[model samples]
Target: MLMMPLEIFATVATGLGAGLALIIAIGAQNALVLRQGIRGEHVGLVVLVCMLSDIVLIAAGIFGIGAVITAAPAVVVVIRLAGAAFLIGYAVLAAKRAVHPGTLHASTQTGTMSRKAALITVLTLTWLNPHVYLDTVLLLGTLANQHGELRWWFGAGAALGSVVWFSALGFGAKLLRPVFAKPGAWRVLDGLIAAVMLFLGIKMALGV
Candidate 1:
């Protein structure tokens, strides 16, 4: 009977490790989240959206929806186009900010974004990335199925990994606020963001 608990723990650990492995990478989503975190703008909302999106995708994968997604090539193409366009547009905005960076003091929050805009941006960064679906729904789903009857537990662990990572990422970024207190810091940060978005957008559009 004691072995049963050990088995469950092992399964959960496997899921947690796999999920973190896939997510803990540098990408457009992570960059956006880090920017928002540094600004202290809707950090909770951004983290919630990211975590919930992962849960839904992971659950879909475990429930056998991954196969459906893999079979639909056209759906991927459409999403790729849409995501690319959004990324390019966002890149332009970032570039503009870098060029004309007005008051961006971290203390007074001179450039606070509206909650609605923040939510929309977060959702786009989370859902519009085709990689999210592939990683969470297809890859993670296949991995969880290896756990047999404990697959749900595996999924739960994967979900928990997302929760832990994003919570830390979004909240932990506050430490950088002091560094971004200067307008030049904002300019440099936005410049980097623009470069990433532009590169990813072009890559996506070219189907690379």
Candidate 2:
């Protein structure tokens, strides 16, 4: 069935709003992206990776991959466990950074991450996050399917939301460089990151 123009617009708007609601939340992925953005380390690549990942996941959900995933409980269990461990480990690192806060000019603290390391870290943060699957694949997919023939249009809006959000977060973080120039700010940011990671890690571990 061909959706009317107004119907298409409404579907797209709904998808965009839903996507932003889920993606805008504070999570490990956003924390890492914001940190990399502020440090000016692989910001473009990181943002691209995040946007692409979301697009792929959204597409998967729209195409019925979510059902396959749901049928395979083992896969989720594995991902959840792995994600929990990785999150906890990352939390420890963030806590250490918080304890030993470094100034923005400190190359060892802010600018020394190799491109390869940055890429790997961002990938792990994105893929290992089970919440990404739940939000993008299952939830958004379900929502899009409700649009019937306009589902792809909904998915496109969701993808655009991902692009807009990551672009804003990754690029906009640089504006805070002045505040981060002080070691105190770094300490606070890292402390918050640590807390978020730890909380998520524990929750995932318990399957909550």
Query: lDDT per prediction?
Result: 0.88, 0.90
lDDT of 2 by residue, 45-119 (tens): 999999999999999999998888889978988999999999999999888888876533423545467889889
Q: So what's the TM-score on candidate 1?
A: 0.94
Segments in model 1 whose C-alpha atoms lie over 4 Å from true places: 1-3, 103-110
Among residues 3 or more apart in sequence or in different chains, the pairs in candidate 2 whose N, CA or C atoms overlap within 3 Å are none
TM-score of 2: 0.95
Residues 67-126, candidate 1, lDDT per residue (tens digit)?
998999889888888999999999998898888887444456566787999899889977
Candidate 2 residue spans exceeding 4 A from truth: 102-111
Clash counts per candidate, in order, are 0, 0
Q: Work out the TM-score per prediction.
A: 0.94, 0.95
Backbone steric clashes in candidate 2, count: 0
* Weakest lDDT window of 10 consecutive positions for candidate 1: 102-111
